[model samples]
Target: MHGKTSLIEHNGEGVFQGLNNPLTVTRYHSLVIDPPTLPSEFNVTARSASGEIMGIRHREWDLEGVQFHPESILSEQGHQLLANFLKR
Candidate 1:
């Protein structure tokens, strides 16, 4: 990640269901990279403004992951994001 803030667009499925789309989050990473390969069982649930994969979920497995720092106070809806995940 390059900026202090990042835009994350949700796919409105899985763990991200009913939450705000295009969420603005605090990013403080030195390097941004994509996964080499994604398994068929996983679904992309979110992406950055630049089309970088930002979130993924395996509904059947009840698994989810996010690339941004949702725990940071700077994130607009970090608390909500965490809540959603816990509810899953």
Candidate 2:
């Protein structure tokens, strides 16, 4: 999954809390063709400017995922995001 860039806007209340900026750029490939219906145990933590789901977490499980590649150079604050995940 690699191509254009997307804006990941943090919801500011989950794993992404305390981020220096509310939005960051990241490389994205896959598109959420359908609106997701996440399980009740999961909480959405971020989204694209167009409202696509970009990040999610399960608080109880200490699990999380993002549609964009945080390791990619295109991601602003990618290191911080990874650090936050690691600190959790």
Candidate 3:
């Protein structure tokens, strides 16, 4: 589930997912070296538990993160976590 990094000094910490598409994987590597450079700001969006966005996952071409694990009560009202983190 992990891929090795090229940096011998900071290597062995593989964050890449092996199951990712080859093209997507290539793009990921490129991004790691030359990041797309976002606005340096945080923007969190709210999504319902039963909503269509919670279960989505992507890489390179798209990016997403889930504030809730949804498997237990640990993530209770997880959307609030995103909200608070974005409050600056």
Candidate 4:
């Protein structure tokens, strides 16, 4: 999967959720950036709340992005992304 894009928060009766995109299990509180096939020169945008960038990491040969689903697909770039984040 790509990642959470253009999502909005949903709240009701003390329950919160995100819609209009991938359901983010992550509350955008802490992001362990795991760059996948994404290029290093590319600027990844992470708008958690209001207007602000959570964090960004510079790398030599790896890339990563957000994903609502736990990607363990070997065919996908999930491993690469995780490796990148852990390796960095």
Candidate 5:
């Protein structure tokens, strides 16, 4: 789902379920915007199938960002996603 405004762009952000760093998450009408370019060593953990950025994860840092509504009732794994984040 694509939109004009900065937020409420896509419905779901297709993510990569990597072996080492699993981050397969879903969104419900996401409003967050992905950065145009990431700094060196910064890895994009998740993104839309069309290549639209979704989530960014720093390689050496504990910082991370999700360009989706992982806390919304419409989200599939909203609670689980937040729980995983808190565990990390």
Candidate 6:
């Protein structure tokens, strides 16, 4: 996927439950797909709460995304990130 480098947080609610840290991320950009319209309450990581979109979810469609590299070894919660997404 095409993306950019960033850091994100996993708020307790939503798809990122049981995680909260300033994680290094990669925000992907899709040339063919339009990004989902996220709600204001889409919980951003604590460090990014000031101004940053970390994760988003479209519950009706069962789609969600985290702007961080949750699978990367760089993330402390990498394994959890994958588990959370897979579980959902």
Best by TM-score: 1
The reply for model 4, stretches above 4 Å from the true place, is 1-65
Highest lDDT: give the candidate number.
1
Q: lDDT per residue, candidate 4, 15-62, as tens digits?
A: 111222222333323434444654556454343343333233234434
In the range 1-88, model 5's lDDT, one tens digit per residue, is 3322222223222232211122334454546444554677767766565566767777787777777666665554557666667766
Q: What is the model-wide C-alpha lDDT for candidate 2?
A: 0.73
5: Cα error in model 5, Å: 15
Model 6, range 1-88, lDDT digits (tens) per residue? Answer: 4555555555565556777565555545422222254455442333343355556666456667655566665556768778877787
Ranking by TM-score: 1, 2, 5, 6, 4, 3
| Clashing residue pairs for model 6 | 9-45, 25-68
Q: 2-87 in candidate 2: lDDT tens per residue?
A: 66777667777555767745566666577662445687787777888888888888869878887787777877777877888888
Residue 72: error of model 5 in Å? Answer: 0.6
Model 2 regions lying over 4 Å from their true place: none
Question: Residue 14 in candidate 4 has what lDDT?
Answer: 11
lDDT of 3 by residue, 14-62 (tens): 2212212111110112222112332234222222322212222233324
TM-score on alpha carbons, each prediction: 0.81, 0.79, 0.19, 0.24, 0.60, 0.56
Tell me the lDDT of candidate 3. 0.25
CA deviation > 4 Å runs, candidate 5: 1-36
Candidate 1 segments whose C-alpha is farther than 4 A from its true place:
30-36
Worst 10-residue lDDT window for candidate 4 reads 10-19
lDDT of each: 0.78, 0.73, 0.25, 0.34, 0.53, 0.56
